[model samples]
Target chain A: MQPDDLSRHLAPILGDRLIAVEPFPETAGRVRFRREGALDLFRAMRDDLGFRHFSTVAGIDWVDHREAVYVLWSDDAKQYVLLSVDLPAGDPRIESASGIWPSANWHEREAWEMVDLNFDHHPDLRHLLMPDGYTFHPLLRSFKLHEPEELEVKARHV
Target chain B: MSEMWINMGPQHPMTHGLWNLRVKLDGEIVVDVDPEIGYLHRGIEKISEDRHYNEVITLMDRCCYVAGFSWEHLYILAAEEALHLAPPERAEYLRVLCDEFQRIGSHLMWYAAFVQDIGLMSPFLYGMRDRDLVLDLYQSYTGARMTYEYMRVGGVRNDLPPGFSAEARQVLDWLSRRFDEYDQLTLGSDIFRKRCDNLGILKANDCVAHGVTGPMLRSAGVKRDLRKDRPYSAYDRVEFDVAVADGADVTARYLVRLEEMRQAVRILRQVLDWLDKNPGPVMAEELPRWLGAPYAPIGREGYLLKRNFPKGVGFSAVEEPHGEAVAYVVNEGGEHPYRVKFRSPVFSNISAARKYLIGYHVADIPPIMGSVDICIGEVDR
Candidate 1:
């Protein structure tokens, strides 16, 4: 499963929404797609492509735009495939993959709290690693570690 | 009976770490479960952005305390790929040596705690006593029992000490014998079998759907050991079997872990033999001056030298003691990584607590969770 293979397979389903499939180290390829085709692509990858194992979802803050990378593994292929989508920084939101892959539930929650990438329609979209009422996305570039800031954390289920 | 939620953790013997398991129960039967983690969260990924490439190894040690070397190796593999560097063959073998030994050490720790959870008290002492020997081997070379910051970005910090192989073989010999005694204590005991058998059964499909791995996944008879499926480091060179069982229950998990320990011993024997037969450089040459020096101070020199470095994204997945641990590193021609993301397997395993915990009796929580081998340090990292 190379970049060409992924591009050839995913192009028919995603069409123009499917951007270029670039070569990534170790894995088959990195599938860059439009945010509009997130759910469709996830379904195609899981049902059609036999990527049964959804590994994780990671959020990267590019400062200008935010990116969410979904790592998937196919037991039949014995390989990993990465799905990357770039969202505008001001309102970084996309359809959640939890519906397609239940494993994406916690990963999406972490991405939402840490990088502030909104996974629209994510069930239980709340603080995962962060405390309740924590307002800051600590993984963003602007969240400096050197500076001290006041924090207000409300106890959960009090 | 009315349904009510009960918190099982934050400080519970079954938890083995800091986290809360909110179990909604109808009398004795579990109705639902919501695990509240983050008690041990240290924002390791956030902190990695500020540290230098090599400096991140320190935090990896704390990422998973029992499996420090495995985490260190994971981060190093990713950082090396992002920087377009590779360790020497000898270094790869040394890493395999570290990984296999760490697996044994971690499993021993899990075994100790797990048996205690199931009311078998004596096995806990036996497991800890045996694990100390493995730690002694680590202490002899890495100079730290738990947090061994020995692996560098391109390679390990140093080679094994003289006569280390002989000492390690002795410990392995002792452990191989102790494994049978462990089976006698647990498998032979009626209390252990009655408590653990047919308990916490997460079948192969549920395991894959919920992103479970390591012993829990293998217990469902999934021959999906990453070392065999996707060989990394010196794993391709070693000879070992993927431990699998069809039970998919607590006993199945126990069987898988025990077999995995045996296979780890088998891998260590081969790695030790290879280390004895071959002698070469552990650290890779042609590294930049800042990263090449074993004890180089974190300074502006690294920043200056990294200006011309090629930028790349590195993704590495290692079959960690708990499960599959992944590290993604992005290098944007800076001394520090632009972003570092980790996928801790325990996190996903615990997230599926609701799937397995519900429908079981309240008294069965300890043995069920014990089989999952919860390591909250990595989960909340």
Candidate 2:
């Protein structure tokens, strides 16, 4: 369907929580929603809008606030609709889309470890790209990186 | 006998890359599988946040060694969108040329590795020999076999050299004949069929739910190619069919990848024909001064803080040789991207290992995972 179709489907369900559903070139449109109504919007987007295929969930550190972007595709509509949710920088937590979309599992894990966005109620949120016990979230703007330095990595005893 | 966990990688013959597959086996049958990645992780996304827009092309080459051009094309598509730049018509066709050739090269690499995993010795060498021809074609124009930082933001770095299309056409012709030989070597063998048929079956719903793309999804009878469904770059201009199969098994994946190579040859012919008639500028003329020359020094006044740069987020999904690869670029009005996240198809394909691998024989892991075409660079990037 088109942008208007998405707008019409999501309007009554989301009410004021749905920020906007504007037309985006090369895509059906980008659907912006508040973090509070994430689960409601995700379910509606999946079952109601026919966007069964979930592509990815990327977390971006906007410095002041954190942004969680979810890309969903509809086989029926033959289009992609981007769903972005904004969260507070200090404690960036949002309802996990993994419950609605099984594909969101790995994407959520990556987002959580990299950008420090907490996926509340995620089935298994763990360090995807980082070693276990790794402390820093390297994707954050505050995590400063320097030139490669030689270090002895301790081997784990079996 | 009791069930026990076996580590198949971190340097196992079954694993083609630097990752571990911990499989729990109950008398040669796989009880469970846990894929442990991050061994090859170089933090490419975090590093992208510190580089110039065009300079990020260097890292794309390291993403997937076999499909560097495809990854480069993916990043440029997103970076261009984020920066609000448009490439020329010829540049678009040239990019298509890069993609189709990369598809052949990557499939050849996959063919070599997958067959070798199943003990098909001769076809392994044959696959590499044919792949070398594609790499030769890449070397002639891009000046690098593996890591050609040829594609720039807005457009490519340069136009095709003289007689490049003729040479490319010759390689395509050779590859088409070799495809028949490839099929005969693998599909013709009884042992090949015995090892592959009805093995590693992942249903259509499982494929979609796990976010599997590329040939794996296509093998499951899903016609969800981004090129056809959501045509990007010069895919809209070309006429080609999406390669698909209904088996959703190892053999079906083999057929899908083989058919896809032929289709890539089909697309390359069209792209080359279009390129021969159209000759134009490769790079966009309206680019900012800093982006024009990525490495050169600018005046004391840094263009990194340029106010004219329109801040936007660029999302690009390309049907890479492996699968559907997505790149999200956040510009945020800086020379460096605020954030860059890549969705590697292999990552999700590997994540669903527990779904497909659990019930299969432990011995079947190689051909199954090999058919998925694990590229650790992109998976860990």
Candidate 3:
């Protein structure tokens, strides 16, 4: 299951989920799907079909759109199957795959920190790598970079 | 035999990074271990949003400081994928050259740290001394000691300076001999071998189940490597075998890393030959280096831009020094990445502690941890 198999074997399955497969023109053997069918298709892919490892999950906000990408890796066949589902531009929510792969626990939390996506059914879904009560989703397109008023002055290492 | 909960570091050296592990110990024996992370979380993902596409090079350095160079490569590839840029053959070969050297350098540092975890200090010094040589090579190319921003989007930032290969050859020649010395000095000393041979035996099934990558997974008898399976850069062109060990123990893990360093040297020599023949542009003609970076700011902007920065979604999984490191880049497609999440190898590989550490003595933790070689920077990043 090398990268070549991704376009051939995984595309049809991903197409069925998003209802239509959108080719990732930038990267070969890559595609995107809609948000609705992400969970059910992911469950089938990870549990039954043997894409055992949820390699890495990423959530992104394109201002008018939100996305959750699940990269499912099958060690036996060495295939990488990607699942991308889109949400509305403002609010984002998706079912967590931590039940299928424990690695998702951190990935999902990180996605929440970056994009403010609420992972439903995520156990202990706190800010994994960001501060608690941090409001802004930095990754969102609308957010602008600001200058902190307080300066953290420290002695330079001599 | 009452079990008591003992807190280990938001700052302990053994715990590595800012992680706090609450282990229930029943008198020098580990009954249970619960790891708590997120003390050093700097909203890197949030900050990645505000920066420009080129600005990501700086943040990627912080992802895994030990293997900062490789993370730079990963981010570059991700950006290149997004922008549809392919590096010239010479640049790809140059990247493979540095990547292998950095891999060896990273493993050497890990070896030193692992030994220190098990209470060996002198070897740490020896390891660091050699590691600097690799860093010196990095400096020659990128002009920085620790965080080499050598890698840029389309390709590398610059070409190798003249007289660099002469110096690298001397260093690689020395590193080859040093690998043998390390084997004789520490591979199976009575104390080291006893702790490593069968302890932390993560079976083949467990390796896949736990998502262990690199030496740890290979030690567990799975011949799975992104480099081998999905050959990237010049890996498909190169002639180096994937190092694997079947023992699936701490010793096997140690051996796999040590041997990988030797194999890296082989790949480096081949790369040098390829570099000599191929001489052209280091970076893609389309993506310019002086996009916005003037002198490289590490000041107040680091805070204001800490959150609500760069925006886009790019996942970069590269063969870093410590197994597989995937940097999930989420951007609103702005100047910075909206979120830059590091899927560190240590996080999942360490989670298997319960499966390996239970029923073992407390004294065994250090050696088992040593084999894993956790770098707090990556763990915390």
Candidate 4:
């Protein structure tokens, strides 16, 4: 099925959850959906939407807004949906989508490490790409990676 | 059933890369598995933010060090998409040829490792000997053995200098002969067959649900090949069959990769023909340097293959030798990608380990794991 065929099939369920749907030209009718909806929308996308394959769950800090997106790709449907969930800039917290998709287990933990987000129901959430005691969210635009004694000493490539 | 914590290491012979799989075991059988990662993660993502587009190929080279082309291929494809740069037809063919050779190399190693895991010593020798031939082919062209920074943003870093086609032909000829010997040694062997065939079976439904792709998925009767379904580069030009075996066991997985190497060789032969006919520009016009690439060379000659990338979002996912390699790049109209994510093959394949490894003996774990050919750099990355 063409990507935009979802609009005709399940527009009622998708309602205002999807903000914009555009057919990417170079990608051969591959559609990108920008979503801003409740946690149930995330659930439906996994269960009902045929986006059974969970690609990635990560965070993006937009200076003003710290947002996390769950990118899901449905091989059966040939569509790409970006579930852009809004999280408060200060103390970013949201419900984990791990219960819905099993692949999100590590990706969610990575998000929690990088963006400092609290996943309400993420079982065994911990530091994935970083150390346990690493407090600062390194991916943030504001966070300065000031050069110290270690990076200078451990420099392999000049 | 007594429950006990079992740590299958950040370092183990069966396990690849640096991952500590904390398995809660009821005696020898596992109850639940928790995969702990990041032991070997060099923070390539964080480092990429400060580098240039072309220079990042070095980092990409290390992503899956065994099959380096697959890693760099995905990165460059995403880079091409981000910069709206399409490689020349000849360049695409060259890339595909190298890719196939790398696939052969990876599968050979995997076969050898799998055999060794299952208490077969001769098969491991047979596997490594054939693999070295493939690796030798890579070394002759690329000038390095393991990690090759051959793939550039718009085109390859170095072109087929001269008579590379004839050299490639010689390698393919040797590989084709060696493949026959390998087939007789491994597949034809009775002991290997008894251990592998119809063992650790993964059904088609389970394969789809777990997001398993490549030979493993094809072994499970899923005739879905990204090379055929979504033909990128010169794959569309060449006509070849996607090798499928409808047996979802260790043997089936073994056969799939084996047949895939044969197909890859066939593709290389065809691609070499195309290369002979077409010898022209490899890079695209109007290159935009990527902001987030590493610095290269001495002096201010600046970065090689550096282009200012368009501030947009583009994703390139192609079926690598191992599995589907997806590279997601987000450009904020800057010198670097604002964010880049590599969807590694090992993630899904390793996740499916729980399904495959649950009921099998600890002795069977190695070959089963080896069949999937998990690249640790990819798993943690």
Candidate 5:
């Protein structure tokens, strides 16, 4: 499918919430959406577009604003579609996609802990790769490796 | 009996790497499981932000020690895409050679470990002894057996050595025969069947929901191999079958992985023939001055000229031996990646432990987890 095809398909459902559907090499398209419409877009992508296979949910700290990228694959289309949403850095939170895609469970957990993005209503949203009670978000732009800080990790039950 | 949690490891034989599997048991049956990771976490992703693009290939080698070449290929493809650089046709064929060989090597390692878990003593030695041949092939060109940092961003660091194809072909012939012997050792025995058959059956729907890929997902009768579905590298040129089994048990996983090894050999034969016939450039020409240098020379006019390369996000998913490994690289017009997030297949497969491990006997843990092929280096990276 082409970029314009994706935009046309999501137009009715997303309306103004859908941003530019840019063409991405190897993928169907990069669908940019408003953070508020994450849940609705996820459902449409999965149910309507046949992107049943959900891959990765990655969070990036773009300094000014945080970005949440959801990479999904369609078995029928045999192509990947990237859903990107930019959230304000001050309060970066979006509705969790785990309800629609159960595979999002661990990916969301890793994203939450690593980049410190809040996946609202993410069940079992605890530390994944990080130690419990570890106060640093290491993947952020501000977390410099050269700067040495006291590191203490407390053990906690999941 | 009342339920109680059993900690399998920070150090345990069942765990191949550093992680803890907390199992709640009622007598001998597992009622619940909680896996605690991070023991092997070295912040590779965070460190990738600081290092140059070529330097990150070193960490990919360490990602999954058994399938270092596969991970190296995975990262390199994405890095090359983000930089808008296309490797030569010969380089793509060479990558297929590396990937197929790595698949064989990784499955052999899995075969050794899995059989050892099930008390099959002789095959453990057999598996390792055979895997050494593939490692020898890697050491011939890459100079490192376990951690080969041979893949560069634009292309491979080097091409196949002299007479490498002939040597690789011999190993392929031996492995193809050994696969039949493997089936007789495992599937031919009734005890192997009793221990593994119908054990830890995660159905196709459950496997999909849990994001399980690779042999584990294929063994459940879901024939989704990324190489065939989304052909990357020279996979499109080569012909092979997707190994699948319907049992969805420990034995089924074994069968699928063993068949996958055969297919890898088939692919290697074709790739080797092509490599022998065609000889061309490996790395892409017209590369920026400081592509592979550990530290790019920062000149007096560093600030202005660095913006020559346009920013792009490169995402790639390769059917790793463990499962589907995805790497999303953000190149923000610099020597280093802005952000690199990898989706380790074992990470998601292990996350679905509750679905598979629950209600099985405590003794069955080793065989079931063995089938999953836990590579904690990538899991906790």
Candidate 6:
């Protein structure tokens, strides 16, 4: 499947929420959708497009805005599809994809803790790799590696 | 009976690494499980943002100690794509050689540890003894047994030493014979079958829905291998079967991995023949000075000469010994990658612990997790 195929299939369901379908290497296309239509796009991709395998979800901090990228694989098409949504930096939130793909559960948790991207209505949105009560999101562009004094980690039990 | 939670790890022989497995038990049966990871989390992703593209290869080696070459190949493929550089064809063949050898080494390590978990002492010694030969081959070329920082961004750091293929062929011959001996020691014994068979049975549907992959998925009779389906590197030119078993149990997982190691030997044989017939440059030509120079000091001189390169995103998936490992490289035109994200297969596999662990006996945890082949290094990276 190409970018045109993805746009033709997703345009009707997403309408204006479907921002654009750009060509990405080694995959069908990169589907850029509005954050509001996140669940709808996920359903269409899984049910309609046959992308059963949920590869991963990644959060990229652009400083101005945050981006959540989802990689999916379709066995029938033998191709991968990239789904990306940009959330506001001040309040980066989007509907969780775990409801559609259970595999997205841990990926979402890692993204939330790493980049501070909130997935509303997530089943268990606790700290995954980070220690509990750790306030800082290390993957953020603003989080400097050289600043050791700024780091404060709290013990989970204590 | 009332249920109570017990922590099996953070330090336990079954865990094989640092991480706690909090299991809720009703009598001797496991009612539920909560795996607490992050004990080994080093924030390699955050550090990748500050390092140069070639320097990231160092971390990839440490990603999964058993499967270092596979991770290096994964990162290199994505970085090369992001930088708009194509490695020489010989480099591609050499990489396939490294990957196949790593697969055998990793599986042997798994076999050794797994058999010992099930109370088989002799097989453990045999597994480790055979794995050393594969490590010796790696030391000959890469110069390191565990953390081989041999792979470069554009290509490999160097070529094979003199008569390396002949030495590797001997190891392959020895391993192929040892695989049959392994089956006799394990499959031929009644204790091995009684412990592993029908234990931790996760059906095909649950395996997919829960994101379990690698030998676990293959053992469930799903013939989905990235090497065959996606065909990265020289995998397209190779001829090997995707090992599969329908049992979806611990014994079935053992069968699948043993077969996969045999197939890895088959692939290495072809790759070795090709490398011998075609001798040429390993690294790509005309690379940017900073990236092409292997011994260049990590200082301002290299950074100052950086040209404005076209920005691109490179995504690559490789069938690591553990499972389907992916690396995403986002190059926003600079000396360092803007962002590098990796999807470790074991991360998802371990997250689905509840799906398979529940309904099994507490005594069965060791053998069952052993078959899963949990490598915490990659999972917590």
Q: List per-prediction Cα lDDT, in the order shown.
A: 0.92, 0.87, 0.72, 0.72, 0.89, 0.92
In model 5, which runs have C-alpha deviations exceeding 4 angstroms? B292-308
**Tens digits of lDDT, candidate 6, A39-144:** 8999999999999889899899999999999999887888888999999999999999899888899999999999999999999999988888888898999999
Candidate 3 local lDDT, B209-325, one digit each (tens): 667777888988888777777677888899888899999888899889998999999999999988888788776765433332223334445334433333334555677777777
Kindly give the number of clashing pairs for every candidate.
0, 0, 34, 17, 0, 0
lDDT by residue for model 5 (B78-193), tens: 88888888888988998888898899999999999999999898899999999999999999998999998888877788888898988888888888999999989988887788
Give the poorly placed runs of model 2, Cα more than 4 Å off.
A147-158, B293-307
Looking at candidate 5 chain B, the ten consecutive residues that score lowest on lDDT are B293-302
- Identify the CAPRI category of the predicted complex in candidate 1: high
Give, for candidate 5 chain A, the lowest lDDT window spanning 10 residues.
Answer: A149-158
Off by over 4 Å in 4: A1-3, A25-49, A77-86, A146-158, B288-309
Query: Judged by lDDT, which candidate is best?
Result: 1
User: lDDT (0-100) at residue B50 of candidate 4?
Assistant: 63
Question: What 10-residue stretch in candidate 1 chain B is worst by lDDT?
Answer: B293-302
Question: Could you tell me the lDDT of residue B97 within candidate 3?
Answer: 87
Cα lDDT tens digits, model 4, B130-218, are: 78877777777788889888877777756676877787788788888887787788778888888787777888777766667778888
Residue B228: error of model 3 in Å? 1.6
Report lDDT (Cα) of residue B6, candidate 6: 93
Tens digit of per-residue lDDT, candidate 6, span B1-381: 999999999999999988889999999999999999999999999999998888888999888989999999999999989989998888899999999999999999999999999999999999999999999999999899999888887778899999999999999999999999999999999999999999999888888887778999999999889999999989999999999999999999999999999999999999999999999988877887778845533666767777767998999999999888888899999789999999999999989899888999999999998988998999989
lDDT per residue (tens digit) for residues B295-332 in model 1: 54466666666544698999999999998988899999
- Candidate numbers, best TM-score first, in rank order: 1, 6, 5, 2, 4, 3
User: Given the true complex, what DockQ would model 3 score?
Assistant: 0.42
- Candidate 2 lDDT over B54-117, as tens digits, reads 7789999999988999999999999889888898887898898999889989999999999999
Candidate 4 interface RMSD value:
2.3
> Which sections of candidate 3 miss by over 4 Å?
A1-17, A25-39, A63-65, A88-91, A130-158, B288-315, B328-341
Q: Tell me how large the interface RMSD of candidate 5 is.
A: 0.9
DockQ of each: 0.87, 0.78, 0.42, 0.39, 0.80, 0.80
- In angstroms, how far off is A11's CA in candidate 5? 1.4
Q: Give me the displacement of residue B380 in model 2, in angstroms.
A: 0.4
